[model samples]
Target: MKKTITFLTVLLVSINMYAQENLDLLTYAHTQDINFFNSIKNGTQVKEYITVSKNSVKIGDTLILGTPTSEEMSIRTYSGSYGTKARGGVAQSRSTSKKTYEFIQMGRPAGFGSIMAAMNGDAASMADNSLKNTTVIVNEIKTYHRGSKNKPLYVVMVLGELNGKAFGINKYLSVMDTELAVESGEILLKNRKMTRDEAIAKLKEAKELMGIDMMSKEDFEALKKELAPIITYKNQE
Candidate 1:
């Protein structure tokens, strides 16, 4: 009787602890929806990212960079931004521009290596060159906001070299946020000129996100509308 009671108590405690781990994360994704296959059939698009799980990732893990577009979800988290210092994240514009510089998020990096040094200083403004059209292999993955929140918004903040020059990057953790940052080997078209299969794959990814509550139905619908024109491109599916 004593042994059984001890085992039950331990099991309950372990389950509770596991639940707490997901709570530590703060994402706009509601993560409750479950419909996945239909979205692909309906024609979405594919966005590849390295899957990030608290259980699998560790400090000092290396993340390869990718090309970044305005549509990319990886919002840049700087030291002084309200998003960086506060709980949750800072407000970001959907169609970001050079004027705002508010969310200098990235998809892929250019060849510039001063991303970190400039970001670490006062009144730092990122130049267009900071986002060079190049890829890199970096060796830093430290927590961004390690205060009341232990996880760093699921984005990768890396510090490594570009031709022996050090740089820094902080962005949202959507697909391709980093090469090894999430599920690998999936590719999504950045714009409207995607192949038939690519378009379907991308929408499928969005649908899955909505099902899991990671995305809202409204956004998913918007994506469908956005890609509607492509469904009838030359090479019909």
Candidate 2:
């Protein structure tokens, strides 16, 4: 009886530890600061790692960097894809027609390399050319109850800071908010939530939309495929 009790106690303790690990990611994501990675790595030649574990509550997933010793962040993921054209995601306007659509919060990255440096937390350092920073742009966060290969999981991206910085760095995990809505002509014609046809309709309806005339045809199509999953949650609503 004593042995059995000891085993149960150990199991409980293990479960608690696992829960704590998961909570750590959510906490860090909720409150990431400039100095978040000070403890994780230095300018050393070691490997850093980041891993994601599923969770509810828009917590998204966690990214851990470092070898045996890992530094992690609680990050969210969002996807946007073009409709039946099934070409996947296409570039659209930053604004959504629906006021309650998902939310995107961005942090100015000091540099691209800086972001990677921060993510790797000193695990690995890149060349000076690789260091660049830009305003971290967020598009979508896809949450799934269970995994499925057919569905595009999720895709999160950031526009690399242009000639301004050498590289973009991961500073804070942006929390994205999203929702569903009926077709509207007011929102940007090319938002993540709109399908290709819908976007075309909007363009014909409203030429004044900001992002519509910006991207080249090739760039626009690529954008569609890449961002296809940003609005995955639209189906849920």
Candidate 3:
């Protein structure tokens, strides 16, 4: 019985060590993510603007706006006979091919009033409306390095309020905010690693703060699952 107890104690120690190692790794990753996010938030210092159309705005939704110069391309093909009629009499062959390219404008930022009008289905009346541009409070910024190292795509979420309601919107901006805009506003930006318990508590607070019930059930579940791993160690501790 004494030998069994000794072995159990050793096993328990091993498990504890393993758990600690995992916790350490998680803390490191969390810290890295937070740091990267802050670098994007704090690194750049210009305030540029883009024009968004009235049709695609949502209230209480975070808006991700790209610069004014992004373009989307579409390729189309057409087929036809160019050769002379090849009836046995003409003795001619026929070949057919055609291609077309269409370029669409994308990533344009919209004025706050236009967005609000679009959301309210009053875009027509607001077509010539002149409203001062509202400032966007950026919350998070991420970048994707595609192909060229110099020109990476930026993903950003900004805090916006319209019609007296506040919410977050995520947008893919061609230019990083840090590259073009200075951070403004009083949103608390997380800059340090959080303990599992603290992280879980923050998640609960965010849910209530964001009106989780207003989000689709699927989205709420997915958000919970995404944060679950970070907080999973809470119960074990």
Best by TM-score: 1
TM-score of 1: 0.27
As for lDDT, the candidate ahead, 1 or 3, is 1
| lDDT computed for candidate 2 | 0.29
Task: Give lDDT per model, in order.
Answer: 0.36, 0.29, 0.33
In TM-score terms, candidate 3 sits at: 0.19
Residue-wise lDDT of candidate 2 within 192-222, one digit each (tens)?
A: 2444454455444443433566546666556
How many clashes does each candidate structure show, in the order listed?
Answer: 35, 50, 10
lDDT per residue, candidate 3, 46-79, as tens digits? 1222111101111232333222232223355434
Badly placed stretches (over 4 Å) of model 2 are 1-103, 108-152, 164-196, 199-237
- Which residue runs of candidate 3 sit more than 4 Å off their true CA positions? 1-67, 81-155, 159-161, 164-177, 181-237
- Comparing 1 with 3 on TM-score, the higher-scoring candidate is 1
How far does residue 109 in candidate 1 sit from its true spot (Å)?
17
True lDDT of residue 209, candidate 2 = 35
lDDT of 1: 0.36
Q: What are the per-residue Cα lDDT tens digits for candidate 1 across 90-149?
A: 454444344212223332221122233333452333323344333344333321121223
Cα RMSD to native, each candidate? Answer: 19.2, 23.1, 25.8
lDDT of 1 at 20: 21
